[model samples]
Every structure is written in structure tokens, then in C-alpha cells.
Target: MADITTTELRQRLQAGETPHLIDVREPWENEEASIPTAQNIPLGSLPEKLDDLDAWKDEEVIVHCKSGSRSSQAKAYLTQQGFSNVRNLLGGFTEYSAG
Candidate 1:
């Protein structure tokens, strides 16, 4: 999986790209803060939620959590499941929020 830094992701969004963002954080964490465009699917529930992301299978999908760890796992799983353009958000939401 590729690592997408917060600044790069922000620039891409600013450029009008609608990349698919998957939040692997827990629902409560997401409720506290999240990117408005991201789809919430807690890490534990990702396997079951795979079908929901099928539409984005061929597109660039950026996975993130509170930190980067969970997002890495999510990226691996998605790639194993044949997702062609899965990326892990570097430093995850923490960095994004900080920026």
C-alpha cells in the first residue's frame, strides 16, 4: 500500500479530487472528529463491510484511523481483497487534525 501524507491528501482534495476515504477508527472516535467525506467502517467491522466498498474497488481508496496503525492493516486487507489503489493515510487523522 502507498502512504499518502496529510498535506498531499489535503492538496488532492483542494484540487477537486473526490478520493474515497475509509475511516477505520471506532464509531465513537469518529463521532468526536472525522473528515466529512470519509465513510466510517470500524476496523473490526471491515471484513463484513467489504461489500459496501465494492463501488470504490477500482478507485483510489484512502484508509485512516486515529493513528496510522489501523489504517495500515486496513490497507493490507483491502489489497489482499483485490483493491487496486488502496493507500494508508500517513500519521492518520492525528496528523490531519494537527495540520
Candidate 2:
């Protein structure tokens, strides 16, 4: 797994690149604020939702949570599951929101 800073991700999105973005935050947290294009799958449910991500297995997936911690775990999990190109959004949504 690799690390992608919030600025980099934001810049990519602004450039109209639709990289796969997965939000590992819970429902309520997502309701507060989230990347509009990110798919929400809360960290706890990720294991059960593996099939839902199968299509992205070979794609560049960017995982994020409120802070970087949860997303790091998510990135590791996805990498173990054979996701070849997974990245943790460094500083996660907190940094994105702040910027």
C-alpha cells in the first residue's frame, strides 16, 4: 500500500480524474462531510463488502476516513486481499476538509 496526501488527491479530482475513492468512515460521519464522489463502506463492513470492491481490485483505490488511521488499516486490508494498487489518503478527510 502507498500513501497519498490530501492535496494530491484533491488536485487529481479537480483535474477530472475519477480515481476510485473509498470512504471508510461511518454513516453519521459521512453525513457530516465527505468527498462527494467517494463510496462509503464503513471500515467495519469492509470485510463483508469485498465483493462490491472486486471490480476495483486492479484499479488504483484511495481509502480514507476521518483521520489517516482507519484508512491505513483499510489500505492494508485491501492490499492483503489482492488489491494491487491501494493507497491510504494521508490525513484523510480531516485534512481535505481543512484545506
TM-score (C-alpha, index-matched) for candidate 2 = 0.96
lDDT of 1: 0.92
lDDT per residue as tens, model 1, 1-99: 468999999998889888899999999999999986999999999999988889888889999998899999999999999899999999999999999
Specify the poorest-scoring 10-residue window by lDDT in model 1: 1-10
The total number of steric clashes, by the backbone 3 Å criterion, in model 1 comes to 0
The count of backbone overlaps in candidate 2 is 0
Q: Rate the local accuracy (lDDT) of all candidates.
A: 0.92, 0.92
Q: Against the hidden true structure, what lDDT does model 2 obtain? A: 0.92
lDDT of 2 by residue, 1-99 (tens): 558998999899999999999999999999998896999999999999999899999999999999989989999899999999999998889999999
